[model samples]
Target: MKRMTTLWSYLLTLLLAVTVSAAQESSAQSLLRSEAPTSLRADKTLSGFGYADRNETKFNYIGTKKDLGSFLSEYIKLPDVGVNKITKISFPANKADAGNSYIIILSEDGNETLYQQKCSIIEGINEIELTKPFVTESGKRYLVGFATKPLGIDDKDFAVLPFDYGSDIEGTSYYASSIVPYPSEDNDTFTLKSPKGLGSACIFVTLEEETRLQTLAYIINVSGTFDPAETGKDITTRFTVRNIGVTDITSFDLTYQFGTGEVKTIPYSLKTKLKSGKTGYYAFDIPAEGDALGAVHFAVAKVNGETNFFANRCLDLPFRIGDTEANAIPRETVLIERFTAEWCTFCPGADPFVNAAVKSLSDAGLRVSYVGHHLDDPFAQPESSQISSYFQGNGIPAMAINRVPQGQTSLLMHPSNFQAAYWTSKLLAEKRGVRIDKIEQTITGDKLQVVVSGVAFQRTFDPENLYLTVILTEDNVAAIKQVNGGANYKHDALPRLFLTDALGDLLSPAADGSFTMTLEGTLDAKWKREQCKVVAFAHDNLKSSLMSRRNVYTAESTYLGVSLANEPVALGQAPVVSAEDGYLSIVGDVDCFELYDMSGALVTTTVWTRLDPGVYVIRIFSNLRAYTSKVIVR
Candidate 1:
């Protein structure tokens, strides 16, 4: 059996490698936020970098200064936020030359000059720097390129050739002109070519959202309800705090209120810094009001006392502990990313199983967030290939269940396996004591307005930094040609647009005051507006790889909602729940359950009295999960 022993050893080694890889995935996610600013490429609204159209024009002649250096220049429409500074300009050239004079001029949509700077170029592919920076307001356009003197060298590339990229859409070519001095001439003799609707320069500039700070708070988990029998005693309930911010959370003042009672303030000056995207907890032994049992309790926050980060900032949540039946729901969100391509015949086999699992999870009250990333598919997006980079695979039909168990991409296409992955993810998420609450979306004209809110439930847990991504996905493309599924593929949850950064908008502790955000979306005509959905999530971006791809945050994570062992547990599954004879009883997980009237009023007393009840809703809970049931008392 020596051969058998060797095979067993090999299997064990493979298992060990898979385990190590899985563990490294989550820790690796923090790399995105940890990367240096200079190393990561900045996100720009308008980039001439993608050389989609290769209409290369050779430099013929350089005109006099009065003509504004017209040998070669690529004018582009600046983003709505306009241009800040043309940091670096890379121009591909045909040949090398020393001290060739060059100039970069900015104008308003092929209009008069707004800003102009002339410099010298070297050889082929030169990165020219502007002597004086140019800045302009939103809704502006500018021409950015180096106008050079006649090099006299034939068949050579020159300045402003196109930023080394291809097939990616960015901007368009406005006009190309050849004239003795053309601001005076207005005829066909001046216009040479225009790659209208399908052109962009080899330029890159900072966008609008790039400047705003992305620090905010998420209320993860709020647990435990008020009890009346523990009269004159300190009744306890706890909530979690997750610091999803850029900087550390050092100090803050918190205000707590139980139901409609008097407000109590608890302020703390901490010795240790609470880093970003980490979870923490707070427990309160609120003095029992004995009689005022069914009122709502919550916490309101005022952040680190920084005015710039504090304004328009708020984080508040009101929840019931063993009180309201409606407040006991703590469902988890499962992110499922499937990697496939039309070329892979077996890829279609996985989709049916995965989608069926999603339905089962939904029916069970679990939120399943799913997306299919196309690899080598005709409908593939650049971001789809980027999504594949998160998981390890060389073949098709691979799936990532919340970025867990990496190196396990192959094998198994069954609904039960899908359910297992989803439920396991849900369980892990619930264990983290995190919760996403209150998502509001409104579509006005072309702009879709959205607001998202959340909170933490365990002890404070964050890494070096954190960011939150809000996504809008459209369902069922309807006409996609599928090789295996059918002629038409009902694509499930295809990502259409990102309200924030694909990498994610930064979140900070200052947002703890209310931990809410508002985003406006300008809908694309390609997306079916009626079938669109919104998904938002937060993660540690400190060690993230988003730096390389301009901060496009990939939700295909391996470890989400890190488990918090010491935190409270779900009370819904408590076995000792019983209600009989017009009296509702709750013990271990809950002290008691309260009955609400038809007008949404609490009608209860501890005198053990019989109710003249018709029907009522009973709300019960601790901190984790809750269940509400209807009962008729006669």
Candidate 2:
């Protein structure tokens, strides 16, 4: 009886030990997860930095410019000090048929090759799983690098990695271009013997382990249909959210804070199951009150009752509330950016088509403005190249309408679709209360001065995010070696100069929602003053998915040197300009006024009565019109 009892106790102890071991094995988890992205923005563009050539190899590291410095061999210090396995690599490429590429991982000191693998390249996003996963060590930093080679077809076939110029990383990207390919697993050398340049090529690695069952969400886009809110009315905003996690998103919460107001959290329950890698639209409403000008920003606060920093995306929504009537016609203007080149065979045919489209819009009682950008041609400028890359104008004879997001249409498209695209955007474009009230253009000697004033028909909510972009375009200029068209072909609306940054310059408006800016640029000797026109437009850096990379609210164009002083003046219609009691008052419905000296130099965009007793040109600008008259201060 004693021996049987002992045997039963031993069997029970063994069974308990086996159960505990199984529980421990279940607790140690492994899940597929991606590292933090080099750029968090949804949009990326093809960079004109350089093109890959046959027999040429380029090595690059995606990181801040400060850390990369002038050296080609730069390493990113691994932030996490734990056991993690890198199983896959992903990146973006400009060309679909790139020949060969490789992903390399170097040791902390950059003297040893930890892991390397050859990856097949594709046009958009390319994902490659490694043959053998690299296990990371604790307290050891690793540097990730990529090497690429061009197709052997021709020298300039336009093959390179798509770059993200707007990355929020610490420093600029670093690269080394070499005539010969670097040997694989060469730990003897730490630096490359090639010319170096700046370019960002983002690469995301897939880790095999992190926290258990990670949940991530990416905010894809926001709606652009949010109109100006009426005072005391609730304004609704909608955004598209995607489940980028391994697990399904059952519920989530979004938080928004308008200006200095209190942050409000709104919870959302997924009626339909949002599986991994799927997207859904959610809407929320907030009361529009108390603030006149401020930004409304939203973020993903929590997912499934847990949160991570990567879940929230930065989205800027500029809001406005009007004190006027609830329903008002939005001041609409169509902005066209035409991409062309002298060597393009089909580009000349696109000119008349665009003009016809513009004329048709004008006939329909719509204002249309356009600017031509030359690509890889003699007339191409740095600003033109920059703008082209930002908009991803990969091909010639492309046009963008109003910069509003099209469902699947690119920001730049073929000329054949310009009319249809324009109409599509016009029909769905959000109504903006902003308008260009007045524009003043003056040419003195070798310089051109422009003043653009704007006003909101309703109260504005965000003024700081409001921006204005001014461009000087020349008309009827002789084409430089036209390819399809004859030598007599004249280029119209060719971009001559950008008075502001290619994107725009921020605006600071008055309390009454009135703003003004004065821009001056040196006139090129080759440019004809009479053929030049100044184009100014108001746009906001609104972080909405429906809006393109940028959206133009309203745009206005005026011919240079064609001020009211050059035309026949009507009595009483002109603004009454007078200088009295140390105050310069222009009694009229003028939105803004500027003072210019007799020499055609701009003095001020504000009312200034401190001028000495002398003859001055007072230019007053109103909605859809401008007036110029000579005034004397005694």
Candidate 3:
């Protein structure tokens, strides 16, 4: 019995020693297993990983053989770290590793005393199902395990699970839908683990009814006075386009037709897109040919291969050729006597009648001259007032025939009838012996000097006080105001300028029957030379008697061959520059010439008359022509 008792004691001691050794061996195995360092951390919840305090419960972890045993003695703190937001998560299908399972653990501290419950991972992404969700007070920590076992099999070969729990939590919930292996019945279930912020929403819609082109047409018309002598005048016509449809019309081209053969195409380049309701205007000018009526038509062509025509609008303009007959007809000078005022209302009624009478007489080979005396005519010139004062007419609508009072007459017919009779009577008498023979005019710059030399058979007027007066007048003046019938009214051919004294000038009729005089004056540059006319008459200073008058003159008032100083003539086209040998020729008329460098400074004035072989800028003014063109000046 003593020997058996001793043997039992020995067996019990050996058994206890073996149990202790096994526990120590298991502890050694747990320590030897690969694990994240104490510095590593993660968050199992949507709140991502970051540094955790050393004392935080979520930071503590344990590694031991027992189901939940502590291995490390002290709590380990993890440094701050972060994981990128997950864009997508993908897994493989039905492969050898498809049925793998994993265990995930998380901790904020490295102490072996504190650890969260393990999470089971399925074949695909197996979101953690939290009984008590892992809350992150400071940072986060996690551990993952992947294992696989077939049905009814105990052998397990766990695949290495990537420790990317921090990556699973995305800041934006709008992550791409992932493709992963099909989950089995045992491990397919998953939870969001923690709530994440919602993503932004988006919406889209379609547009309806695009813009379309509608009917477009160009219409042109010319309406103005026509004269035979002025053939190159420009007649302006207005063009307008209207949008006729409900939709907006965009770009369109306009083709203009002038007469039968002349055609021009104008393109409309619009900066802004036209809306549904809009209209545009185009003003074009057509040059007037001599004695011909011209018509213009417009057609619209759209960008989208569409064309439209509005009605055919035609213009009938009358033009005349040759000189006016009114100027050639024998003129019976009729003295127009009239009294006028600015404040009189009744004077306007008689103005038109007088004007009509003058026009009629003029058309019928008669020359009518008028002296308008005004008491308060607002637009009356100082000269007109002076004439009225010299006549010494009392009351309004008073008149004088050739500066002589024709008895006080209220009738408007008095001036017209008396003046005509007086002129006819004087012409029929034919008692004057002196007659104008010759008159000549020459222009130098802006100065006009006229030389008048004539022969006289009889010298009856006073030689010392005989005065000569030159009058310049223009035809076709519109919108002129005058006084008639005790009122002020508007008329035309109201004398523009009277260059003479009350008793004109002295002309000594020589015993040799010859006389000569020179008249010089400056004319306004803006005056049209073509329409200008010069009239010279003789008057006596003593008796204030008329001697002789003449209306023959020359000098183009419309086309001044020489332009004003510093106001160069604008060229209507670009000049072509040609070089042959060492000489250069510029073949165009330009307003000015200039040469500039790349820095845009005026280098020199290019003299067309003298230039070395080089290129230059020939600047011409006029909208119908180019402003500047490159010309080779050699």
Candidate 4:
């Protein structure tokens, strides 16, 4: 009896010990399951939630009707129905062997529906979508679970279990899946559906704390045009900025650093309840009076508990200002005199070429002054008559470049040669003795006080009659005339005043020394100040004659300087062509000619050496470069 009793006691103790060990193992399994990995919930509710884990036999859950009610009160509001409903479930076909077998069961009160939906999950993240087409009653609740082992026949093992939803729960019930024997880590996704009126909820199945906050930064680009000839200004830098990120950017500051020392800062305010995506523009203009070579930097910071900073850097922009004084005045001054008459027949033909030459030179930074002395011209003055008489000729088309007759030639020529001659004389005369030290011009009422100082070099050239003449010319004058060449001759640089021997009687004594002279005159308002010029020149009056004066020593002068003389030649008029010998030959003293296309562009501006068999416009300028004509080149 004693031996049997002892054996019974030993068996009882063994059974108790076995029960204790099983309980301890079950507790350990639960703890391990609770400590599984998880992920933060995404903003898209219907796209199914994803969580990282090492557990292989784990099932995800949609918050039950009761849990959702508690969630709505504790976390965020529910989403709309369309965004909350799960449309269809899809899984990768290639991962069909990665333990993808499962069943979806719905329970409302005592009514339970088992859905045999198959899934193919890979060893990585697996997505299990559910098409819960049926709606649940108001008081009904639902939950999902994963079984460690196959479910038992009894309902007691399927009861709800305790879980940690990352926070303390008040009115929510604890729910856990049955313990299924599998690996400790896995990845899974779950989708849920709800009624149209009741919004959806997002579930975050995380096992650790979040370490990083959502970060955002932005950059701005700017471009523009700045012309130096238009505005004497330059831009240092340009930039634009906007809050182009998911988080609200507060206390945003933009700084532009152009070159080394150019820097500017601007502060801005941002939205407080900033959502995931929003944008705003911030533009800044560099101050007109700032450095032009600098870089631009942008910095953004969130005004939360601490400053969260984001920054980006950009380069500087460089531009030019306006045209400088040196570009406007390249050479010294040159004086040009256009001697013409109202009754002159061919004078109008030469006007355009002369005017074009003057304009081209002026545009090239060479200061040129012109005078149009009209003789027998309805607008001619006694001074014009005296000047014409001084030349000892009654020629209608005459020009005195720098007060020296153009080789005493009575012919008109192209203005281009005249332009070249004038430039050459000016360049050569810059080193001559007859130098103009300074010319100060001031107008007080009707009188123009011009103080001009002329210094002669120690060595004089020839023993002859040297005379200094000062002539005043006005611009923008209009006149109507009926000349034989063709009426409507518009004239510019009309000479209004002239002075003989303004410096002295003449160098008749042949003195070899230096001298200075100042000349003054009065002008009326009929002449515009901006379009007037004073031309002064010294020449040998004895050597100047009408017929036998073959050797002319007059230098072409500009407002800037003087040029050596080029013998002027008379350009002949176009001859009347006749269809003879299958060729057209020019007649008369046609020293040179040019052919232009119908568009008035010069095609061949050389000597009239060869005439092609085609229609063309022929331009004839005198060797003096004073007169011109247009004819057919055919």
Candidate 2's displacement at residue 404, Å, is 4.0
* Runs in model 1 lying further than 4 Å from the true structure: 1-331, 363-365, 375-378, 405-430, 457-459, 511-514, 542-634
The clash tally of candidate 1 reads 73
Rank the models by lDDT, top first.
2, 1, 4, 3
Off-target runs (Cα >4 Å) in candidate 4 are: 1-334, 359-367, 389-394, 402-431, 462-464, 480-490, 499-514, 542-634
Candidate 2 at residue 20, lDDT?
21
Looking at candidate 1, the ten consecutive residues that score lowest on lDDT are 557-566
- The 0-to-1 C-alpha lDDT of every candidate, in the order given, reads 0.44, 0.58, 0.36, 0.37
**Candidate 2 residues 1-634, lDDT tens each?**
0112232233222322222222243222111111223342235422111111111122221211221121222222333426878776666544544435667776655556677776666655556677998888865656655555533232223233333322122111223342122465332222322112222234555677755335666565565322456666777778877654556789988887766567888888888877654567888776765535455667787888897344445576655555432323454466778888888888988877787666655444345677888877888877877666456444778887776554443576676775645584564455665777677777789877888886755443244567888888988889869888896999988898999987788887776767888999999888887777777888765333334436677776766764423232345687787888646877778888777543233567777547765556666777766676666666
Q: Candidate 1 on 510-584: residue-level lDDT in tens?
A: 434235667777888767665666666654442332222112122211111111111233444642444577675
- Please, what are the lDDT tens digits per residue for candidate 4 over residues 583-607? 3355544455555332222456554
TM-score of each: 0.36, 0.50, 0.29, 0.30
Best by lDDT: 2
Q: List candidate 3 stretches off by more than 4 Å.
A: 1-347, 352-381, 395-401, 404-426, 475-491, 526-531, 542-634
* Residue 452 Cα positional deviation in candidate 2, in Å, after optimal superposition: 1.0
In terms of TM-score, how similar is model 3 to the real structure?
A: 0.29
Error of 2 at 510 (Å): 2.2
